[model samples]
Target: MGCILGRHDSFVYPTWHSDPLSWSSPLDSRRGPLPLSPSPQRGEGERHTRRRAPSPEGRGGQGVRTTRARRDGFTRKVLAWYARAGRDLPWRRTRDPYRVLVSEFMLQQTQVSRVQEYYPRFLARFPDLDALASARPRAVREAWDGLGYYARASNLHALARVVSRDSDGTLPAEPEELIKLPGIGPYTAGAVASFAYEKPVPAVDTNVARVLRRVFFGKRETRNGKREVWQLAAVLVPRNGKRAWKFNQAIMELGALICVARKPKCPGCPVRPVCRTGQSPVS
Candidate 1:
């Protein structure tokens, strides 16, 4: 696929699909106590599959087996690479949700180096959700000067109020809940969930979208490509929740540093072995 990247209206996928009540209703309504059947023992292969089922994606879903394997391999390679090569970012050093949220907002249309200088100052002024919520919108906008996306800053200020009043000054840990906040959409929700709360959700940005298109789908183009790109990203998150942060960061770092839109350094990429595009330099 020739990497078709564009902004689209963000859609949130429901987290819980199966209702336990629906499954238990009829069985529980029986007058007499129902005899419970012993659970069948799975064969060795089945056991192995069950054990390894949680790919970078949460639980294995239909048509996701191959996607999970590729993502797992890619995640491991990228995280390993990140451990040695990842940049010393300010947000990486903190576990605070507010800081992570700020960095993510700044990073929407701005570069990391540029965000770095402003991040500390911004945080220094509006150190917490309460601080941001209480500050004037103009002050926040003024502080966000040079970062062109005025809407993001505006939304961030609005979100602070929402979180402060509605959420009781705590940002929700779930991606679904985060998306309900002002200025937070699919990508930002996923990024905050994975990066801040250690939830295994995929945050696919332009760089991530390009890296995925090139590495997995090769050069074949498809309709609704961006949605497919996000689906691929969601499946690749590591099952081990603790590694979700590292995994998400590694991919973003790879896209930012190695998988440059122009002149990608494929030869030096750790996941090059699995990359279908091979190690050829970008034309």
Candidate 2:
């Protein structure tokens, strides 16, 4: 398994160890690190496999272009961009499961800046599952003031109580298990699994969805194309849970900062050549 080199910033997520054999080696040494086995060589056919479905005129017996190479190129660009430009957030500072869980819950339908203010305070008040589970719902709600999304606060309280009682005061590390908790959906589950437990599940948020769609599918209209994007995301995550964490974060950061919804800074984008949407101005 190949290693993933994280960004230099102190707040960036920590470097993930994919395999014991490669653990001691430098992260930049890995070449063509595929989330799946036997990383594929860079080529045209492989690069175009991820492009959009053929148009009606190009359908029938006509050959359809694959975007596999473009996907690989885009992935590399995004990863490189991520290594240099990923954000520094409080939750990313630690690999603690509780912190990741809290961050994920608070982040739903909320901005990172807003969540930042509430995160430390909430953690300070609850500290751990035991504290949260033992605290009154009203107290939890009080701590969640200004965060809005009252449902998140309520569900978090319910989740804490359940986790404390059922899991012996421990949060499950697996995505499947985490999904069983209140307020945890597929995205949150994948996030906690990858960010907290280093699982290889893909977490597709709005940013990731837009970036993947534009870079791989070349389709600006993703309103009805999320499923395909998610499938592609699943295929892109390395089987190694640790590397998956880096891959997931890198992609999300790319979407948030570079492959933005409007006037994407594609010129400076690492995956510019592979992107079918044309070159970015920043490049």
Candidate 3:
């Protein structure tokens, strides 16, 4: 139950599994879809078998890989869970960068229900980046009236104009390029890149960050702990772009629906077995 810190002071917890694929669950796809609600906790007598996992570098030291042991199993479990439980939202159905961009902009500092109400309506008014760029600022603001973050509206408009003019109405596919656009930050940029372009990058929004902290770090982090979470996220993402897209969305969805900000349903979480916090006595 000891802990170690990397050179950057990011916490890495040891896991017991020797083979990432060795772990199996009754929730396997062959059996059936997972129930919507979490199952009850196990009896006190039941516990997982333990075996020391090898470090990424094959030797332990200050620079040991944080995600080496957990990455494959963690990604597999989350992706499998998502295949069964993920919501079929409108934005999730498309790879259109403009549509994804709009969703990201509306989703910032706003609730998903409200965004659902306004998303189709706004998209109906301005169908693409060109349409948004061509519309007057007043019209754009009017479209964004209920979303509340008026500045996001302004920034979205600015971004549309910039991208429309410069990129020939196509949004950038890299986080680095996307971040340069208006209203888009690291999270939004990564979202756009992965969701739209299937880029294998990390997007550490509030929900994703919480899941990463509790599951990987095994404790609550300070408000400024986002950088460490982002690092962990980057390391954990699958190298394959398609799998990475699913991984990114799966983690975010897990955070929003199961591993919520308060009263996280750890008992039902797909990643619970490998999760530091979920496996801890306190959870």
Candidate 4:
């Protein structure tokens, strides 16, 4: 387990914890801290066998030059960059599930600056799930006025109602369960789970997808490439939840600020040494 260090004016780093009670944010007593999927248990006395390592093609979803050392280096470089340049945003400060949900909903297809303007205002009006659930539909829509994609607001409202009524106002801490909520797709679910609950999961948005493809696959976007990108994302996520949170945020930040869709700023990229696109002579 890991704990978030003090809110630094510059960089924020995740520190490992021997005791979970020392965590920066209080954990849900019921669900506890969710972990990555468990490995299959092996029976005692089973004969050990050595098998040939899989070829690059056989190791699907991993990076182009995937290896323990390579992966660890990649993680280190990204975190170091984040330490130097990660943005201090409103959503990154809290572990409250309700606030995370609202932020994720508001951030969909919206710029960070715009979300920054609207997030606090929306939370001031409807502070929690119960408040959002009890609000009138028109009011919710009105709060989301300038933030295009009105359907997201409606879905978030519906999700709040369902959670309040059926789940006793407790938002689920797991991505699998979070996905069941209205308006929350895979990416949003992962975002809320990892960001709010510190679950070790990948949150792949357009920026994340772009970074993963260029760094790992070294190719332009394709309809068939999404599955591989997600696989690489999942494989690359840190096992520690708090570290994973920083990793996900760092990668997304890298994509947004450096790996722009048009003419990426590769000269300043931190992970350019290991990135396929960055290393390419043509790129």
Best by lDDT: 4
What does candidate 3's lDDT look like per residue over 37-148, in tens digits?
A: 2233333245554332333232223222345557678888999999999878899999999999898877776677778889999999999889998999899989999777
Write model 4 residue lDDT over 1-283, tens digit each, in one string. 0111111111110111112112111111112212222212223245433222222242333424456666678789999999899989898899999998898877766677888889999999999999999999999999989987687787788888888987899998866566555665557767888999998877777778777778767765444465555556666788798999999899888877887677788888898998878886434
- Scored against the true structure, residue 114 in model 2 reaches a CA lDDT of 79
How much lDDT does each candidate structure score? 0.66, 0.62, 0.67, 0.68
State the lDDT of candidate 2 residue by residue for 11-54, as single tens digits: 11111212211211111101212121111222313322222222
| Residue range 123-228, candidate 1, lDDT tens digits | 9999999999999978999999987767778778877887888778999886545655666655777778877888766776667787887787666666445545
Model 1 lDDT at residue 100: 92
User: TM-score for all predictions?
Assistant: 0.77, 0.73, 0.75, 0.77
User: Worst 10-residue stretch by lDDT in candidate 4?
Assistant: 6-15
lDDT of 3 at 197: 96
Q: Is candidate 1 or candidate 2 better by lDDT?
A: 1
Q: How close is candidate 1 to the true structure, as a TM-score?
A: 0.77
RMSD per model, one decimal: 12.6, 13.7, 15.8, 11.7
The true-versus-predicted C-alpha distance at residue 115 of model 2, in Å, is 1.5
The Cα error of candidate 4 at residue 88, in Å, is: 0.8
Q: Order the candidates by lDDT, highest first — what do you get?
A: 4, 3, 1, 2
Candidate 2, position 208, lDDT: 77
